[model samples]
Target: MTFAVNPNASLFLLPDPVTCFRSASYNQIQTFHLTADASAVILDWVTSGRRSLGEEWVFSRYYSVNEVFVDGKRIAKDAMLLDDSQIDAKPLPERALAERLRPYSCYATLFLVGPQVQAVIAELVRRYQAISVMKMKSPDKVIWSLSPITGNDYTSVIVRVAGEETEDVKGWLGEGLEPLRQCIGKDVYRQAFR
Candidate 1:
């Protein structure tokens, strides 16, 4: 059975060379599978575009989607999206596949702003060590003095802990944060432990 969505969308199939060389019929079947699998397309990212004084600037929305399928299945068993907003700062498909595989793993992202942001981050690292969570990736923090000429004061980070809830993580790190100077945006999630 053939499946199609947007009639305007074109499909290209790269078939197995060996089978294609042996018989044209086998090549046709492989081509069919490729087109069939690609019939379903999802919009993963869209950014707002506006012109200012005849100049256009494109901002990064950081929106994306990852689809996982079962063994030998084309249909996705699970789909997850990177979602963050002022009201709801959480990753999509809360019941993700990794959650099932590793029950104790947790992930949290922090967006901080302050002059003492570096000190706050240092204290946070010390506390994370106390909790014994592995630092999966190098953090991306910006210091005022080291930052570019543009006066943008904000630091964003992603960290993984050993629990599903990041309440403790936020509470401890939130201590040194200054109300007027610091602003924290966080998103908590569960994933397979590495």
Candidate 2:
């Protein structure tokens, strides 16, 4: 899918989580083009197949790519590929893709771009900077990170989150992005989170 935002205009894209099925492959690509003054919020996320059916990470493959261009110049590009067939552990016991991502069943990525999101970016940065990571016996229920796109005016931010359950990630994201309500309006923002 592709999107184009006009100058000074804002757009919000909140899509449902993608679910991969066993023996199936899922691929998605999205591109956004925006004028210097345009603003946009994009979200891409996926679940680890049907958990109740015991099909977690049983899919053959999963691929996703998201790119953003401002004034015809590429600002950010995020891509991920997970394939069971690509696992090759010749010297050790057999390994599966699920092993690499154990303890997490949901993953999400969010992008905020343009002047309108400066406040959101700043808030996220402040919160992220205050975190102190420490070694633990078990992984956290949810983990997230925030980073700014380098080489660009500090108007863009990328957030990645992984959680043991889908609802956990959703709640975290909803709170983290609460400032967006001012730009996208309370009604629209509530729709996305609710």
Candidate 3:
């Protein structure tokens, strides 16, 4: 899917999670074009198939691409490809895609750009910088990272998260993006989380 945000306009994109069924392959590409003064919030996420049926990452492959452009110049492009059939385990135990992404059943990526989201970006940066990573005996329930996109005047940020449960990630994202309620309106923001 493609989107174009006009100058001085704001856009919010929060789509449903993509679920790949057994032996299925899924591919998605999303592009966003925005003027220098435009602002946008985008969310992309995927699940480990139908967990209740024990179909965790049983799909053959999954691919996704997200690109953002500002003022006709590309600022950020993120791509991910996961294929279980491409690996060749010779003489050793075969490793599945699930093994590579073990301890996490859900993954999400969010993009915040333009002047409207500067406050949210600043808050995320503050919270992310305050975190102290320490050695843990077991993996944590959820993990996330925040990075700023260069060449955007510090107005763009990308956030990636992985969680053991989908709901956990959703809750975390909802809380983290609470500041956007003022920009996108409480009703519109609530719909995204719900």
Ranking by lDDT: 3, 2, 1
Give model 2's clash tally: 0
For residues 1-194, write the lDDT of model 1, one tens digit per residue. Answer: 24332332322211111111111111111111222222221111111112223211122122222232212234322222222222332664444223332332222322222232345445554554465334756432211111111133223222222222233323322342323122222221111110
**Which should have the higher TM-score, number 1 or number 2?**
2
Q: Which stretches of candidate 1 lie over 4 Å from their true place?
A: 1-101, 104-106, 128-158, 166-194
lDDT of 3 by residue, 25-63 (tens): 899999999999999999889999998888999999899
TM-score for each model: 0.24, 0.93, 0.93
Q: RMSD, each candidate, Å?
A: 23.2, 1.6, 1.8
lDDT of 3: 0.90
Q: Model 2, 56-107: lDDT tens per residue?
A: 9999999999999999999999998888885466687777879878889999
| Residues forming the 10-long window of minimal summed lDDT in candidate 2 | 146-155
